[model samples]
Target: MSKTLTITDNRTGKQYEIPIEHGAIRAMDLRQIKTNADDFGLKTYDPALMNTANCVSRITDIDGDRGVLLYRGYPIEQLAENSDFLETAYLLLSGELPTTAQLNKWKTNVTLHSMLHENVKKFMEGFRYDAHPMGIFLSTVGALSTFYPDAKDIFDEQSRLTQTVRLIAKVPSIAAYAFRHSQGLPYIPPDNELSFTGNFLNMLFRMAELKYEPNPVLERALDVLFILHADHEQNCSTTAMRTIG
Candidate 1:
């Protein structure tokens, strides 16, 4: 049988019944408790939001008490141990692990897009040398919207996919340039031959050397860290980004 909650009002000696779903009652169900048509019925009183289910995530899940985290039905620990950042990203986006061909294609596309447009570099250079790196990073990302106005087509799947790849590919470049600008150094172009995190390190730290090879241990460490931190279910920053998105 289905479930419901019964409420008894002492003032009028009246009772009310509210249907329940998923072992919970909707706030709207409480509206039936009013004694009169003019009454506002029951209203929320959660000033501290101590009793709230803020959001329902389709991508990730967290069970704090159990110390468990999963991404697309796979435990996070397994992914961190067995997969890299790009593979985890593919699973998060497509809801499954990729085949060898799929992973190769994804890496190739991301690598090819690692270089930021020359004009974007000029835009970063416009900021004062002393500007905060974080501030420049934020403004640079905002400016990216203008450069890819098609990203505004939120309802279109192809547009979203295109822009997601572009943003993910170019953001490391943007961040590297931001830091380099704060120190008044010429920006280093992305090295596509390197891994995703490796290219970012190259851009951020490469000096006069014509070739930069990222350390194997360091590269894998960064990749694993990226996988671990990738999806924090509906945190403050993700919430704000979701609102903006």
Candidate 2:
């Protein structure tokens, strides 16, 4: 049997029943609360939304009490043990693991788009020598909107996919560029021969005389870290991004 929540107003003894929907996780239906004073005759205050359930999501779930986390219904431990970052990313975005051909296509597209626009490099030059890398990352991402105007029309499925790939592919380059700028090092172009994390490592640490090599153990460790931190339930940045979108 499904559960329902009953809310009663003390002022007029009015009652409202909200149905509960169960998925891989559980969430209470609250779409009925359309307005603050009009619907409930009062406002709820939750500074920073510290204890609020503002929306429902099907992506990931965290059980802090049990120290358990699941991504797309797959346990984090299993994914860390057996899956790579791209596989984990595909699962998070598409709700399923991709077939071999699909994964190859996805990886090819991501690798092909790893290089940023020439104008993006010029934009990096404008940042002050001591500018914080995080600030630069934020501004560079915002600038991506201008570079790809199609991103504005997300209603188009193809445009949305293109922008999504561009973001996933280009962010490592952008972040690496920011770090290089801070250190007064010339930017290192992404290596097509390398995997995603390998390319990022090359861009960040490779030098004119010495090439960077990714260690298998370290690379896998970083992959697990990325997969684990991919998304959590409405942290500060994720909540802000959702609110803005």
Candidate 3:
């Protein structure tokens, strides 16, 4: 027999069988279980989403009971040890790890777009030196939507690709700017020669050095962090971002 949830309305003595999909009953399906035809039936009140699956996603899977997480079907530990952030990001976005040529193209495209517009730099400069870096990052991220009006073309594949690449390439630069601005330091532009994390570190810390070199260990650490946190399905922060933003 096909999977289904047979819900009994004890008050009316009515029973309804709702189709179960992917081992979960849809909340919308419950709307059919009314006290009477005029009644609104049921709504799930899951505070903190303890018993809720907020979305359907193919990217990440979490087995909280077992303390395991997977991104694009790869174990988090495996990805952390074997893949760079950009490679992991490509995997999540494309549903597969990139080939050597594919990764090279991805890296090159991301690097080329690392430089921020002069106006964007000036916007970051307008913030108070003591302003919270998180606040600045959030505000600047919102401001980015205004910078790329074409990103509104949600139906266009190329537009989505463009916006994704732009956001991925530019967010670290803005984050670094936020860090420097909080310290009352001049913002350093992105160094295309550096790796993504390396460029970010350079932007945050390069003072008089002609070439800023990020600690190899820290760079790898950041890459690992990026992989793990890249897509935390149904995390509170993710929920808040979707609700507010």
Candidate 4:
């Protein structure tokens, strides 16, 4: 006998039943078996420390020589070509492609919270006129810990969500502010109407005296750039996430 998996489409409010044969189910059950059998009998001397990369979820498996990188199982190239950074982020956290409605709701939540507090802005102004942008950026993010000590709550889902939203929304804003500051110009506010890359371009180049026309070819290229840069497993920054925890 075979079994079926039932799934519902949240956006359209529809349901589906996918049939699975017994042989297919058996294959799936077998795939879950750990292939590295030697570790089964090994004894650990340090109980507090992980013996062999206990942090599997955080590190993405990439066969770079094969041009494949996956967060869990979702393909990076597909995500880069077909999705935006925010939606890709949701995929990273939830382990599934979000429905169109889910994507819209998620984007709206992030866009609405993009602006930083006035006190943070004021603190940024105290940096020396010639300070490097990266220094300012690191210090500003560290300062966030002081403002919301609860940001350290890694295990709390809501806190993690809040911090994720804040980071995604504010990173470009802070970057743009640094560029303008280097030129002795005032910081520009973000335009909620623009997409992530679009807003970054606007913040960096848009001005009252000039009209900025974004080229579609360039926009697509920039989107590709962000997607390519979006995530890499166990890179320096990702490794930092593990260390911080």
The number of the candidate with the highest TM-score is 3
The runs of at least 3 residues in candidate 2 whose Cα sits more than 4 Å from the true structure, single-residue gaps closed, are 6-10, 13-18, 22-45, 241-245
Provide C-alpha RMSD values for all models, in order.
2.3, 3.8, 2.1, 12.6
Q: Which of candidates 3 and 4 reaches a greater lDDT?
A: 3
- In the range 124-239, model 1's lDDT, one tens digit per residue, is 88888799999999998999888888989999999999888998898889999999999888899888788899998899889888899888898889889999888887778766
Candidate 3 vs candidate 4: the TM-score winner is 3
Q: Sorted by lDDT, highest first, which candidate order results?
A: 3, 1, 2, 4
lDDT of 3 by residue, 55-162 (tens): 688988998899999987899999889889999999999999999999999999999988888888888888887899999999998898888899899999999999
Model 1: residues with Cα > 4 Å off, grouped in runs: 11-14, 238-245
Residue pairs clashing in model 2 are none
TM-score on alpha carbons, each prediction = 0.90, 0.85, 0.92, 0.72
Model 4 spans with C-alpha error above 4 angstroms: 1-54, 209-213, 237-245
Better of 2 and 4 by TM-score: 2
Q: Which is better, 2 or 3, measured by lDDT?
A: 3
C-alpha lDDT of all candidate models, in order: 0.86, 0.82, 0.88, 0.72
lDDT of 4 by residue, 94-136 (tens): 7787999999988888888778778888888999989998888
| Candidate 4: residue 161 lDDT (0-100) | 85
